[model samples]
Target: MGSNSHPAALYQLRIVTRILALVILLLVLVGFLLPTEYRVERSVSINAPLDVVSENMLSGQNLSQWMHVQGGRVESFDGVLQNDDSIRLLYDESDEIGELTLLEHTGNIIRFDVRPKLSTGLVHNRITLEDHASVTEVKWTIEGDLSVGLLSPYLAFFANDIAGQNFEVSLLNLKQQIESQN
Candidate 1:
């Protein structure tokens, strides 16, 4: 090279830096512009007998005692368990009321589909039991997805963390409730 002035090189470097910064900004914008889908799954285990714990979950009336909600009331029932089954009810989370439906019911497993407040899709909850010697492991798992959009990824991440904690807390509360009954 001939003779590059100090100021000339400095100006060139500044221009290059500005272009690089613009490219990075564009990349970030594009990253957010891309569509994304999110799914969250959370579970917790409680120590109890499989039959007893599973029976408790199947009893729809007992849901209010352990679940995260403002309150829950049984609407109507037409099942063998009488008051144990609820036809309709609301699980209140702040101002959000989750409409729940009893999807499937078996001996040791109960599945409930929840339509969250104003969100799209339904969250499926499966409660099952596995015996461990004197104690049965009661496992409650929630699996669902959020609507896709720019905020979907962020919402998904937050929902995963919050929903996981919610299940953990519910399990802890359930453990206390069941144990206290003894």
Candidate 2:
């Protein structure tokens, strides 16, 4: 008889390939429906006053001393608490030049807009403080947009996993520095 079994195997292979292609297409479509925005918040309670916490978190020199920006060390931070000033950032690598501008400083809240030179979007950060006798709550939040480009929404979905660890480390460092100084 003719090799009908060979034709059957080829048919099965084509079906599998078509299934895989459809699955990939569906995944891409689902990604398009997702959001490209992300917000990450991390907090630590320090045995310090609100003023003390604000000083440490809002001061440029103090911030550069403790905060690690994208695993990069701060070269020089300018315009400490200078409202509406566009403070420039420089890392050891010249290409790491970025812009940080102070947006607001209200009663117990401070906001900033940060844009990395190599990035396509700006990150808006807010630090909120709540004071309780003998212990102060410091909440650090970062939100950003990556545009609606393919894979941007997926990238945002993992933003907390990626940026949260960095924020924890930075906050821990700040806590230690503040507590140690007191």
Candidate 3:
């Protein structure tokens, strides 16, 4: 009876080991198949005019008021926020921490190519304003590739939710700032 019980226990252990091995293999395969690029977008409606929202966004001032950035000031910029204009920002009074180049600045749309000093990937940020009768719809989008080779897929899986939450908070701040000013 003892010998039979020992064989049964060994067989159960083997089965459990095989199941764990298959699960690990499946996870690895899924990781390899996941997309490397990720995009995070968030939007809010502001009770302001399109021109007013555009002015606030293009000025690059009041960024710290709405975003998580602190001690932000425009280091260099074209007078009119045209394409190819470069703006440098410093965080927490540290050295210039990030660079943003204007990719497009047209009616109701502003786009920037952002490069953060701490990151290896390029971030594309676009802010679009759609005019409604009494409110303007503001959409903020950030798109980039993880660029971490094999670990990119795992990182991207959570990128949207994490980044999206940040965007949402910033947008809410922007809305509050604009509404308070009006």
Candidate number achieving the greatest TM-score relative to the actual structure: 2
Model 1, stretches more than 4 Å misplaced? 1-45, 70-96
Q: Where is model 1 poorest over a 10-residue stretch in terms of lDDT?
A: 77-86
Compared with the true structure, what per-residue lDDT tens digits does model 3 show for residues 5-108? 99899999999999999999998899899998888888999999988877776655555457643345345333456699776656666765787788998889
lDDT of 2 by residue, 1-182 (tens): 46988898999999999999999999899998988889999999999998888777767677777776774654455546767967666766456678777899876898988886646578899989899986888899999988847889898999999989988988888898899889
How does model 2 score by TM-score? 0.85
> Which parts of model 2 are misplaced by more than 4 Å?
1-9, 91-94
Model 2: weakest 10-residue lDDT segment is 71-80
**1 or 3, greater by TM-score:** 3
lDDT tens digits by residue: candidate 1, 113-157: 766554557777787767776476766777766666556656665
lDDT of each: 0.63, 0.82, 0.79
Model 1 lDDT, full chain set: 0.63
Q: After superposition, how far is residue 168 of candidate 3 from its true place, in Å?
A: 0.5
**lDDT (Cα, 0-100) at 21 in candidate 2:** 100
lDDT value for model 2: 0.82
* TM-score versus the correct structure, for each prediction: 0.65, 0.85, 0.76
